[model samples]
Target: MPSTEITDDTFIRRYADDIAYVAQQPPATDLATLAAQLDTVAPRYEAAGITGHEDLETASLHLDEALRATGTDRDAFLRRAHNLLRPLVADMTQEYRLAAGD
Candidate 1:
């Protein structure tokens, strides 16, 4: 049977880790793979009304470009990526709590 309860919290936590890991140690190649991984989480954000989908898409492109260009700016890229993701996570957490009346 399909689960009725929303698992936004679980997704938020897991995706945050994924984002952090990617930002910290992005793959040597196949950046699209990373973006595709991120895409998996988009629906959860949309469901929670948390914006930044476009930002993630844009970031994915830039991150891939940056990784390919210098290959040594992972720190900077991580900072930018985390900056974009952190607020979305926070907002989603808040929305989930509010919806749950917690």
Candidate 2:
């Protein structure tokens, strides 16, 4: 699978925002929505057995870089981090379901 190409400043910032947003909420439909979105970008991660934790670690690196570059606000950054993480969790959940033939 091709590597995720989330290098643009705007994309990174938005992704970071999404990650942060999801982190604040309890598990809900929004988390599912974010996962569906991420499936469009890095489905291979799920296919290749990467779990939510792995995805979070990867996203954290990117988010950290973006925060440093933009000096994002704390609340905004936390929300973004949550948003980014929700999808990874969702993706892994789906992966497990699919693997188990759900």
Candidate 3:
């Protein structure tokens, strides 16, 4: 959670936006790109010191499940991923926005 201040450069904002954007698209629209983006989350999370954030962990589980599925299975998982992650992303974005004084 944010306190009174946070930098706009924080990694979670971009990561949240990217995940939201990808999740909103039709699953088959770009599975390869989605997978590529999901692959970056771990290293980025480690760099961002995002451990113990429940929202992030939940969102990551959804993304990871989607990453491991294929074809129609992947599509199903992606749809659920969007549903599961949307609120987590929104909460994170709102915290960052408030901290940034937006």
Candidate 4:
């Protein structure tokens, strides 16, 4: 079966739990997963006319590098990923709320 197109709302729904988990307590595995997830949806975000698509793409790239460098400090990588993703998630959440008239 073909997958449905990714919309901002759908993206949020897909990642909300993961986002929350990362926000509260991010592990290396979860950060990797979130990075992969972000990379997957970056093109969708651009196609959906979302702002900050470039920033998301850039962040995802950084995360990819972070994941690759095994000797790097895990805590530092987590912080970097968290900092990069936090505002993106906030913007997406606000966009969703406004679209839904909440």
Model 1 lDDT tens row, 1-102: 953331224333435544534244443234445556565545555675666666776556555654555434654554465466656645654565575466
2 against 3, candidate with superior TM-score? 3
What is the full ranking by TM-score, best candidate first?
4, 1, 3, 2
**lDDT of every model, 2 decimals:** 0.52, 0.46, 0.46, 0.54
Between candidates 1 and 3, the one scoring higher on TM-score is 1
Off by more than 4 A, model 2 = 1-48, 51-54, 58-72, 100-102
All models, RMSD in angstroms: 12.8, 10.5, 11.7, 12.5
Candidate 3 regions off by >4 Å? Answer: 1-53
Model 3 deviation from native, Cα RMSD in Å: 11.7
Candidate 4 per-residue lDDT, tens place, 1-102, comes to 953443333434545554443233342244466566666556655665667666666766766666666554543444465556667866764564464465
Candidate 3 lDDT over 8-34, as tens digits, reads 133234344644342343322343444
Q: Name the lDDT value of residue 43 in candidate 4.
A: 62
Better of 2 and 4 by lDDT: 4
lDDT of 1 at 99: 56
Provide the TM-score for each candidate, comma-separated.
0.44, 0.30, 0.43, 0.52
Residue 45 CA displacement from its true place in model 1, Å: 1.8
* Model 4 alpha-carbon miss at residue 11, Å: 17
Tens digits of per-residue lDDT for model 2, 11-90: 43445343333333322233333333443434444455655655565555544544455434533554555566646655
